[model samples]
Each structure stands twice: as C-alpha cells, then as structure tokens.
Target: MKKVSISLIVISQMLLGLTVSTTVSAAAKPITGVNCNGGFFVRTPDKHIHWIDEETEEHVQVYDKSDDIYAMAQCGTGVVTVFEKQIDGEQQYNAIYSPNCMNIGSEKGLSSHIYQGKEKINKIDAKDGKLEIRFVNNTYLRGETCASVSAGK
Candidate 1:
C-alpha cells in the first residue's frame, strides 16, 4: 500500500508540472486575432468619437481619423459614426477615415481592410434629432456603435 501511494503521488506531481508549463507559455505568447464582441468600443459625446492610440495610449478625438486596434478597450469594436460629403447622391468615403470598430489580429498590428467596395453609406440613418450610424469594416472585428449627434452635426 505504501509503494502504491508513493507512485500515485509522483504521477500526479508530473502531470501538474506539465499543466503549469503549458499555461505559462500560452499566456506569454501574444494573441493574434480577436472577435468583435468586446474587442473595442466607441464613446461618442457631442459629435466626437473618443479614441485611444494603440502605441501611445493617448486619448485622441479627431472625429474622422482611423486608428489601430491593440486591445479590446483600445477601440476594437462598434461602428464609429462619421459624416461624409454627399456627392451626387453618393457618399464619398476616403480610406483611413471612418472605420467601423473592427480589429484583425496579426503578429505586427491590426488589419484595416473593411471596405464597402462600390457600396457606400456605412450603415447610416438620420431621423429625429438623433442619428444612428454603423460604420462597416472587414474581418473579425466589425460591429455597430450608435451615438448622439446634434442636428447638422
């Protein structure tokens, strides 16, 4: 009985060591991709979008400037509302501006490839005193984020 007990204890210790090592390595490795559920978000107040710079972590509010998606709280989710110029009944959207909060995971950085092709109007709707706009993007981190905008804002 003594011998059997010692063998079982040794075996359990070995398994525990293996598990610990695996968890450590996994945590140390950087994550490449993330789902759009909570990867990022947008807080809109008074017709401005709040953004946190990925590298600097600086609080920036440039309204229509597109940035990176490093973490979930770093603005990787939701549809960032941006106003575009209406040209002949078509909204002209310039790249590097007004991206739906979607973050693509990779080794280097986030992927900003969410384009509407020939289709414009990034899920925009204007009605009463408020407007609900959902910018569109491609890949893993695309979601809708609605906010308050004053009339003519």
Candidate 2:
C-alpha cells in the first residue's frame, strides 16, 4: 500500500508538469509586424507591429500624427486617414486630412487637433466608400474615401 501511494503521487506530479508546459508554449507566441505608414496598420512577418520613431529608434507602440492623413488622403483622393496609439489605457490620435486643410495653421496641423484633448477612437466605419470615426467622447468625424479601409485580421 505504501508503494502504491508513492506511485500515484508521482503520476499526479507528472501530469501537472505537462499541463504547465502546454500553457506556457501557447502564451509564448509573439507579435510579428505592424506597419504604421501604409495607411492601415500592416503586420510584419513576426506578427508584431513595429513602431519606431523616425528621429529616435525607441520602440513606440502608440503614435499620433496628422501628416499621415494628408498623404493617405492624397493617394485615396479626398480621403483622410487618422491613426491612434493606445497609451496608458487612453487613446491618442493623429488626424490626417485632404490638401484642402493643409497649410491652415500650426494649431490645425494633422497631429495637433486630434491630440488636443483626452480622446480616443471608439469605432471605425468604412461603409459605402466613406470612412467615419466615432470618438470616445461621442464626437464624429466623417470623410469620403476613394479607396477602402483594409485592416488585416
């Protein structure tokens, strides 16, 4: 009876080790690539999005820029693109718009207006060739896009 009790304890320990190993392996999968400049966020080969400051190589997970909207809008013909970065549980944004709003003022720059306050994007609507964004504070910004929004799943 003593030998049988020891064998059962050993078997239980082995099973527990196997369960832990399986859980750790699944959680170890990393994010490969994320492309911030390509209008929509593009994923890299490693499944992680790489956010690098052009001036500084610091790994940035969230970025807010206004210039990106102008460029994407220009390419999409009157469509503006806004990007957001989640920082400390809040959303920071950079608004990009058409050439029509370019050279307006420093206060109206692509990154300025969107980051003016503590707001983050809540929903994205790319329906009927229009891109509509709803903010966390219930404000809405709408733009007409010649191209569609393709966020890679």
Candidate 3:
C-alpha cells in the first residue's frame, strides 16, 4: 500500500510539472497584430453628433472635423443620442466618447501608414479642443472642438 501511494504521488508531480511547462511556454509567445494602425470608416459624425474624447477621459463635444483621427473608443462601446441638425436631418451618435482605449501595442509608432486606407476614425484632442476624421495617406478632416467646460455641467 505504501509503494502504491508513493507511485501516485510521483505521477501527480509529473502531471503538475507538465501543466506548468505548457502554461509557461504558451505565455512566452508574444501576441501579434493586436493594434489597428488604420482601417475604414463606417459613419462620420456631423453637426448633430457629439462625442466625448476617450483621450480626454472626460467632457463631451460636437465631433465635426475632417482629419486623420482615430476613434478607437467607437469600436468598443459608449452612449449614443439622436439630435437634429440645421438641415432638418435626424442624426444619431454617442453623447460621450468612451472608447476601448487602444494602446499603441507592439507597433513601431504612428506613421503615415497609421492613416492609410482609413475609412473612419475620430481622433480627439481635448486639451486643444480639436477633433479630426482621418483617411487615406494620413489625410484628415478637422474641426474645432466645442468649448463646453465640464465645470458648467
């Protein structure tokens, strides 16, 4: 009985070692293509649309711009509201920009390629009150961010 117990213990130790080794090996490998340097835009915000720059991490503003911008927050999730424009068109959009907060992972750095073939991305600079919609060849559509201080809210 004692011998059988020792054998079971040894087997368990071997299994544990194998499990640990596999986990370590899997974790050692790096994740690739985790960042979205550029892509296509689906919907562009206009006068009726307002959003918070996840970059600012606070404050909401009307995202009316044309520039090479990245709205990573839009890809994740956030709040949306519908409002009217001067042209009497109904527009729907997030009242605030709560982006997924994309970190420039693994990629070398932001380059012209960052704006390549981009269909839609809303880049916001809360500090400067600037917003931009970026597209091909690092081209952009820009606008002045609305100056509605959060203190008023």
Candidate 4:
C-alpha cells in the first residue's frame, strides 16, 4: 500500500508540472505587432520633442514649444485598449480607453512620458543622462484610435 501511495504522489506531481509548463508557455508567447494608427510623443530633458511612429518605427523630431510632456496611443478598430505608463521615481498610470489617442493620465513632473498600448508592453529605463523606451507588442492592436477621436459615432 505504501508503494502504491508513492506512485500516485509521483503521478500527481508530474501532472502539476505539466500544467505549470503549459501556463507559462501561453503567457510567454511573443507579441508580434500592434494595429494602432496613432503615435507617441516624448520630450527629452534637453527640450527636444520626439514623435515615435507606432507602425513604421520611425522617429520624427518636432520643433514645437511646449512645457508639458505627454504620451498617447490609440487603437485602429472599436476595441478597448489598455495604456500603461511607468516613470522612474514616479507613480505608474494604468487606464483603459476606447479607440482614440488617450493620454497617460499622470500629473507628475515634466520630463518624459513612456506609453504602452493594449496587447503591447513597454519597458522604460532611465539612467545618468540617458533614457530608453522599449515598446513590445505581445498581441495585435484591436480598435482604431482615430474613430474614437472623430466627431461621428
């Protein structure tokens, strides 16, 4: 009877291991791309404005004069998009929005804004005289950002 009980325990452990592996694999799937039509605005400490293109991965310099720095992302369809932003030594902002250019919704100091959209993950790290923003798409963007921004329904 003892041998039988030990065998059953081993089988249960194997099954548990299999379940955990499956869950991890599903969660670790790579995000291929985002289906958004909007871009993100980032203002560096040197007073330079950078417009990051989500689709083309191009960086455009804007010569506008603005005091506040903000980042926004919008979807392409009518699906809901989740936006999250994290700043060094600052409170994180996480919010849900429709298909439009939604802000990060933070009232912190004016330096830089890092934005991440739905099905996308953003990793931001700032060090001595350098800032890095990495936008990763874990899944496709669902809705349209312009539709929500437009006046029509």
Q: Which has the greatest TM-score?
A: 2
Q: Note each model's CA RMSD in angstroms.
A: 16.0, 11.9, 15.8, 17.1
Could you tell me every candidate's TM-score relative to the true structure? 0.25, 0.31, 0.24, 0.23
Order of quality (lDDT): 2, 4, 1, 3
Off by over 4 Å in 4: 28-153
C-alpha lDDT of all candidate models, in order: 0.36, 0.42, 0.31, 0.38
Q: Which ten residues in a row have the lowest lDDT in candidate 2?
A: 63-72
**In model 2, where do residues sit more than 4 Å from their true spots?**
1-117, 146-153
What ranking of all candidate models by TM-score puts the best one first? 2, 1, 3, 4
Model 1 agreement with the true structure over 1-153: per-residue lDDT tens digits = 999999999999999999998776544222233222333234342333444545555544434323222122122233332224446765544222122343222111222323322234344433332334343552122234222222220
Cα lDDT of model 3 by residue, 4-112, tens digit: 9999999999999999987765542212222211221122333222232434434223234333222332222221111112223432221222222222211122101
Compute the lDDT of residue 30 as modeled in candidate 2: 22
* Model 3 per-residue lDDT at 36: 18
Candidate 2 residue lDDT tens string, 1-153: 999999999999999999998776644222222223332222233333323444555443322332222112322223244544566876545544332323221234332232233456666555455766677788876656523332212
Q: Count steric clashes of candidate 3.
A: 18
Q: Which stretches of candidate 3 lie over 4 Å from their true place?
A: 28-153
Instruction: Write the number of the candidate with greater TM-score, choosing between 1 and 2.
Output: 2
